[model samples]
Target: MSMTSDIYKTIAKKSPESLFKDRGSKFIGQAHPVKEEAEIERILTELKNKHSKASHICYAWQLGKNYEHYRANDDGEPNNSAGLPIYGQLQSFEVTQILVTVIRYYGGTNLGVGGLIQAYKTAAQLALESANIKTKVITEALQIDFEYALLHTVMRIIKEEQISVTSQKMELSCSITLAIRKKDLNSIKKRFDAVFGLTVITENF
Candidate 1:
């Protein structure tokens, strides 16, 4: 399967708990920051090359929805052996916007289905915990403009009110753009009215 979901999150940087190493295989799990598809490809390539001799490399990433929104790849392992287990571990932790690559240095034996599942699950679990990440729901483009005299005031208000002012550059007027949270749109509008009276609101972006 493939990941096409749209959830946003960061990776954790801590490892997991348990002596859950089922031998026969050595696993190294790594968590990565991937904000775009190209970056994801880059990371996968780097890891694949790094552990070129690993028996199998399975990975998964959670985007947003379900279906293929959850993506997993078996690499060169048995079908459903590598990726699905990793995907399950991610889902178990409710972590999104994360990429996990599990490199397996195979022992001279086959882990069968059960053994393979445990090994993969353990690797994914460890990698995810180590990532230690955070994320917030973000929206794009809210333009708040005012005369130059009030630019500082606007910026101050935005900061004090916990609004994220994303941009503050433009000509003639002191222009500001904030990454307005979906829930705070109305509140921002009201404050805009209170402070800047003639504030303009546009959904052009």
Candidate 2:
């Protein structure tokens, strides 16, 4: 995705589990696509339960189309050694709306902080590399209201603009919600505003 574009890159689904070994320690990494902060804890809990014997579970996640919200957790590892390294990989891959977790199982030996960073970074990178990355357009919803008599005109404009109608209520009066690509919002809104008796309301998503 281009830096100035309304498109963003994200994982399409949960990635296959990946593993990295360093000295005697084991690091297992997995990446998941997430939309809300609430989903993060649930995923962590499931991983904890699945890896009950593991020593630590470090993770990092980026959310929003603009990558506005994010978090990193060391989960008991040395500060900056585990979570930050994992997060760096997310930045390196230029992906958002994703969570990458590295589960560690102590193998009876201590990898120094440097070693731990390398191990976690490699694990996270491996997980992301195995993921199905996809580019998605950022969109906004527009609520359009018009009279039934003008349905054909409104529908014609929608078709011409290739806009997707997400929901609609057609009666003597008509109300429809459209999902508009963020980049085309201004031009599309202008077109609808020019039509007499039509109302357009912008809804950010």
Q: What lDDT tens digits, residue by residue, belong to model 2 across residues 48-152?
A: 999999999999999989887889999999999999999999999989999999999999888889899999999999999999999889999999999999899
Judged by TM-score, which candidate is best? Answer: 2
Q: How many residue pairs of model 1 clash at the backbone?
A: 20
Candidate 2, residue 62: Cα displacement in angstroms equals 1.0
List TM-score per model, in order: 0.73, 0.93
Candidate 2 residue-wise lDDT at 40 = 90
Hey, what RMSD does candidate 2 come out at?
1.7
Once fitted onto the true fold, the runs of candidate 1 whose alpha carbons sit more than 4 angstroms away are 1-8, 12-21, 64-68, 137-139, 147-162, 169-172, 190-205
| Residues 1-205, model 1: lDDT tens digits | 2243233455544344222346567877766655556777887787678878877767887664222355799888878887898888877777666677788887787788888877888888877766675754545467887877887677777878787766677566677777766556677777777884447564622
| Per-model tally of clashing residue pairs | 20, 0
